[model samples]
Target chain A: MGQQALCYDGTWKGLLSLIFDVYAYKYSISAIVTENNAIQSLLFTSALIHVVTEDIKSARVTKGIITSVGKKGYLELYHVFLSEKEGRELLILRTVQYYLGVKEQASKNYAHADVLEVKKIVKSVSRERHRMKAFIRFQLLKDGVYFAIAEPDFNVLPLISKHFKDRYADQKWIIYDVKRKYGLFYDGGEVQEIEFGTENRLDQKSISLAGHESEILYSTLWNQYFKSVNIRERKNLKLHIQHVPKRYWKYLNEKIEMGG
Target chain B: MGSRIQEKLSILADAAKYDVSCSSSGSDRKNKDKGLGNTGAGICHTYTEDGRCVSLLKILLTNHCIFDCAYCVSRRSNDVKRAAFTVQEVVDLTINFYRRNYIEGLFLSSGIFQNADFTMERLVRIAKKLRKEHNFNGYIHLKTIPGASEELIFEAGLYADRLSINLEIPTEAGLKLLAPEKNHREMIHPIKYISNRILQTKEEKKIIKSTPKFAPAGQSTQMIIGAAKESDLQIVHAAQYFYTHYKMKRVYYSGYVPISNDLRLPAIGTEVPLVRENRLYQTDWLLRFYGFEADEIVNDMNPLLDLDIDPKLSWALRNMDRFPVDVNRAPYEMILRIPGVGVRSAKKILAARNFEKLRLEHLQKLGIAMNKAKYFISCHGYIQRYADQQSERIKHFILSGSSSKYVKAVSTQLNLF
Candidate 1:
């Protein structure tokens, strides 16, 4: 009726299904948040009801949005959802609302605030996804499962799963996001979302398989090769840090000064 | 690998760092048969302290050159540690590094150990072993040896994603001054042979369909800057020649890091001409993507690029009549010509301006550099603010107005070419 927060299950499809009902039932809501997220906001100052996720309704909304703005624009909106930033749900609704109000395509309307904001957010999310692809460093364990741990700034583990799965189709590898405490494990045939140890503080030794000789050898060779290729006359630590930021130094085998 | 292999890797990788072509892109090598790798746009896996990308495990098969090229560090006369890797050792290193995600793939170059064909054969053997024995689908780039037979180069193209031969100097006269035996004709022979074979193979593939891609990434070359007496004009003309003649994918400009104390070249402490190198690269970008001819950027009239401003902005300043371009009405080409607008910003303008007349807010929102762009472009209801300003004043306004952070960065880091 009045302005209220609507809670959806913790998924992009759930949000789309919730938006579908928001339009179909004419429900007035201030924010569309995850059921877990809505609890925090509802405790202070809003009314909310759990919206069940329906595959059929979500499919209808997906088609409607695709018809308004093409697949490329739809992907831009989806990347904003994957970003999971503050006020992201509201921004998506507004951009959808603006496009639905117009006859012409509103995706490229930089003159409008909502469209421009979506462009900015999509760029940032795309950058994080690309960085995850680049910064992921896999270490070979004794069991021969190539293991890597990343704590990206965003929830990009889900975004980069297909890339790793496709590239290393022959090998078994696991990419664990310590911050999210979830991982994607590819077992040579298919990928499965997994959960590793409780703390996510996998100090190098915890993951390093015992008596695995080649792991240490390759890591050492990598660190040595990294240092050797640098031209001392052109040493620019500032530029190096900009490309491989300080926050990711711990995760990378070459960036670590010394380790197991 | 053992400690012996590690030591050899250090020596050979250190020796090979000067080549500076680390890209592992432009290859259509797909991962079939559930094997190792597939290349898309290249990834820079790590950066060195010098801020150069370590995309590939760029290493040499051996550092045992017989030539005494003055600018080269591994010259026969220069006293540096020498090491060699057996073909099997190189294959193991590449496969293992690739598995651990430490690199895109292998970039194998070598110092001439014996005659040209012998050295070229060794390089090809390493590539062939990786592709055939291991079923590796990784990006491989090999350096074409000067005076090597066409058969070796052809074998290399079948395995390597890309092949390159370094011109080493901008002009024949400059090359002869430093390295007496080397000439442009010798380098051109290999490039011509490869280009011709690439064309013939491409034609055969149209009919055969299973011709098995022959160097899908195409060939590229590198020339050292600040090594010899050559102007910006000569350097650009040489690049233009390669682009026109061979359809070269890229021409790398590696600034001369004083590696040898040769009497024929600059003293060891001579500055690296980093600013000049950066400008030349910016000019290179214009030639490749920004619809600019080499002569337009630098000609007989103006042989040197301006150090204070970028080449694009310098061009816009010199051609003063082209300013105040209408944002909404101008075609995509004219919008691209605006000094501060990059390819991304130019595309955004073309897409966004179709709905309505672009205003100041819209232009800023599109992420074009408004600090420099505002003087050159006009939008809805906005008159040119500095209409009658001279080129010198505009250049100063653009430079001094830019953040001090950029100017400070130029001193330390070499900009990407």
Candidate 2:
């Protein structure tokens, strides 16, 4: 199958160049690889190569995939690329390209299995987005910076900004997507991206915030509340663990001091 | 006093955990002009290790009591360490917790300390301090002491969002045997008094705009299920009485967890019957929201909720003549009688069918779970074949797996927490 070896400025324009080359090739392309990182090196052996140019007309045609699907779809495509699922990157590109061609008639053929598959993936992502809103727990860090760690099934961190920002307008907070290795930090006004470097440890003991009196008092009170609320007669340890999994207990204030 | 406060909070909060009326809904007051008040959808600031929502600063004024309620951990004769929070201590904790947004407000219930009036006065003082001295407009749900006077009950309504007077047992004999200090008259009198005051306040509000909201969120009561020999029908009847007579916003059913070794209560080996509680809640929803009456749901003949199936489905099976409700022509109330159709699905069917004569496909598109609804409803002259041909067999088939599915759904949601 015909392939493209495209290199652009690591921007949407660069991605669009690759999309334009797919159609221009006039041969159904097998894959497109970015040259800066040798992504999927072994798979590129039998593929044909075509260099991408900064052609505005071609780029605009390619950008139409984003315009047709809206921003949510565009971000999903980005996540699909980041997910590194086998053939996912190619599938997203192909899906976007297919969506661009049949934007208007997409809803008419609801019975089609391909459309159903796309809808399921989109819906699953949306569900995870909503679940994160319900489950995200924030902890008070040493610097009075409220921090929370989440490992959602999908890339939901980007979607959670509007909620946290609105609800906690006065507080400085950081919500780290531990699985994604990146976090969003809001400094009481605006949010910015922060990366947890390779040396950054995930151990709770290592990141201790020593002298926050209110945090300590709150933690103690929470522990008191937790101890008090459990009905001894109806103590179902199995059911309790089932509800609040031991996995999430590390960051939970009530469960933090009481080691699992 | 400090150690006592901590000890009491620990024991009482543990005791009070099973009481699930801590939900703060219905009130719309926001942080008015700078004083700390929030009317947002109540935030659950903490989750216990068991993962239950900690929306309110739930604690008891004291775990010390004069009564020996069989189902209560705080029963006077129990050998557990007892503790009590002084009025100042409770007020301080509430204000401190509220400032930190650690809780919505206080859910203050107490085991009878000294006497009913003394306990009620202490609880009232904490609430008064929170409202007047601190100017707190947060949600507060206080459990009304059964024998507390009308004046204290009035103050409770004035300061709290909701006041609850739990009718601990369904029958008077059960109350007398299990909790001698508490009587049927003591519980009902306060409920009736509060109900009257609530009604009067509402009427007064219509005429006078400046009148304060008296229990704006309204009153609710709890009934301990599985403790006494009361059937689900009798329990539901009590709930109906509270709903109609007392004008209670909710009748919370807490499955009896036998905490004391009293022969008067159910055996300790018996499970709390959470499924029974769930079934009761579903039936209660039908009563309040779905317009199903109590006696029609569970009569003296059919006294117990069929543990195998939901009350709605069981009702549908018994009245098989009402089967094959024509979805297109049936009213909203009639459509609600269909087994799988919930309030939302019924509304959707009404809205969608108005546009066109609904087929099975149209019903599915409206998000009705067709597997359950098909046996109960007909669409565009299409009736379920087995619904009439093998009615008994179909009923058994539906009833068998309903409880398992109900358990699974609850377990799955619990996992999400």
Candidate 3:
């Protein structure tokens, strides 16, 4: 039973390093939480222990996971971690500890609650990742860089970065997560994470000030195309709203009412 | 948007909305040259008011037609504002929309303005310019104009990702009754030619390293449902013909939306309930993925689909002798036939059962709908009691159990597409 809690930095590598220390230090943790979550962990249990993050420890745990569960299984664990769902760290740490002990592909054992939850959480995260890719609406700025703002449900920027980089290899673009306050900038050659801080977060007016002369024309044309393709006979607002939910409509070019 | 180009776009897009082959999958085109976009699984950029996927910039070259088909909105006799986009306009629109991630790619269809050859050449020219001039590698679905010269249609396969020629009506008699000028013979020729050419190109590529790709996403076609007095069995037979003969990626069954008051077609204001269109799609899925044949879904005896339940449930209800399948021992094919077990759940059952015997709890964990599947399957923890009941009693039990108000509302929505 994990009565005493172990805390580390809120990073994937930090979790892995904690798993490394779990065996080295021989500390039985009742719960695995981030130091960022340490203040709230006291509500459940008063005892909180903070551990240092070490690169060598995390690297060893990473190799062990890949060797035991394979590449796809490792990514599933990473997505479950990234999902930051309630009690996710404890669920993964326990399942992985059990999987490392067994030779069979125990991570895929749906009979166990931990294995099933990992799959379910990964599926939801992957769905959100796909929705982000489909719903990203970019604007052509005056500086010749395409810019878009996304507010996804999960921390999916790391997941979708490769898809955008490979598909839009020629263009310079930035996809900034407004909620996360961090953005990814791909300048035709490299992808770099950039931050605007809380106060300097970018807005539409400032973004549009640097927009190209042809930007308005293209967005307006997109809005027009969005309206024209609908068949009136098959109109079902319930289904339409289900496919493209109201939450994503704020950034969609067609959903935004056109100003005449 | 400017008035002139915007006007043409609305006119052409409004004209081309009915041809619903909006899938952007099957193309292995990579953006290797650092061009614009690439194709993978289809992505719906947004949905229309009718809930159809707005994946492609689906528009026409022009809305002015030479032939008058009673089911068509762009018929020569119809009174509408006709407009057309020039070659450059189509190319520019596709590029801009693609760069902004507004659409997957272009779906350029057209009404025959002059002759079939003249119109097809213009459509091909647009595809060529997008590929060679702009290096646009996104999914391009070109409409293969019927009766166009064989060489011209072949050229379209070289540049476009998918090619289609609509059968319009499912059966020959339906085509004759709806449009006397059109015949199944002329429409089927180009599809057959393209199919042969695709196979021939694949054969060449196996030996020669430099052979170019031809319609890498394969082909698809759409048929208007409920237009002619054809039975559902005829529609399923026609769809099976396309899939088996051509190895088609899809055969879209679009419900007949009455646009005109033609005596041969459904009159205006008669709504084609989405339920019928949705049922045909379910039957299509059963045939293609569930190892079920065309005759099994519909036959001379049961020509029409049951409007109350799905085709799979209807088939299961009629053949109740095959119930109470042992999930722990039954094959994947058998598990797929169970009412609530989907393709994904069936695969998961086979995978998870390799480690341990799958029980009712494991099946529920794998996301199988236990409500209906519980009656058909017996696992370690649960045994079916309803399998011994009469067909009518079981049907009524399942139907009433699923008639929650939320389920009733969502069932009306066409989420199957």
Q: In terms of docking quality, how is candidate 1 classified?
A: medium
Model 1 alpha-carbon drift over 4 Å, by segment: A41-46, A197-201, A209-211, B403-417
Q: What's the C-alpha lDDT at position B260 in model 1?
A: 68
User: Can you list the residue pairs that collide in candidate 1?
Assistant: none
Residues B194-241, model 1: lDDT tens digits: 888888888999999999788889999998998887889999989988
TM-score (chain A) of candidate 3?
A: 0.93
- lDDT of candidate 1 over A102-125, digit per residue (tens): 877789777788898898888888
Which 10 successive residues of model 1 chain B have the least lDDT summed? Answer: B408-417
- RMSD values for the candidates in order, in angstroms, are 2.5, 7.1, 2.9
After superposition, which runs of candidate 2 have C-alpha atoms over 4 Å from their true positions?
Answer: A1-136, A141-145, A152-207, A235-247, A256-260, B1-8, B34-37, B40-54, B88-104, B131-138, B200-210, B351-371, B380-382, B400-417
Model 2 agreement with the true structure over B233-268: per-residue lDDT tens digits = 889999998888888999999888766667777667
Number of the top lDDT candidate: 3
* Candidate 3 ranges beyond 4 A from true positions: A1-3, A39-49, B404-417
Q: How far off is residue A40 in model 1, in Å?
A: 3.9
All candidates: TM-score:
0.96, 0.74, 0.96
Task: Give per-candidate clash totals.
Answer: 0, 1, 5
Interface RMSD of 3: 1.0
Query: Least accurate stretch of 10 residues (summed lDDT) in model 2 chain A?
Result: A105-114
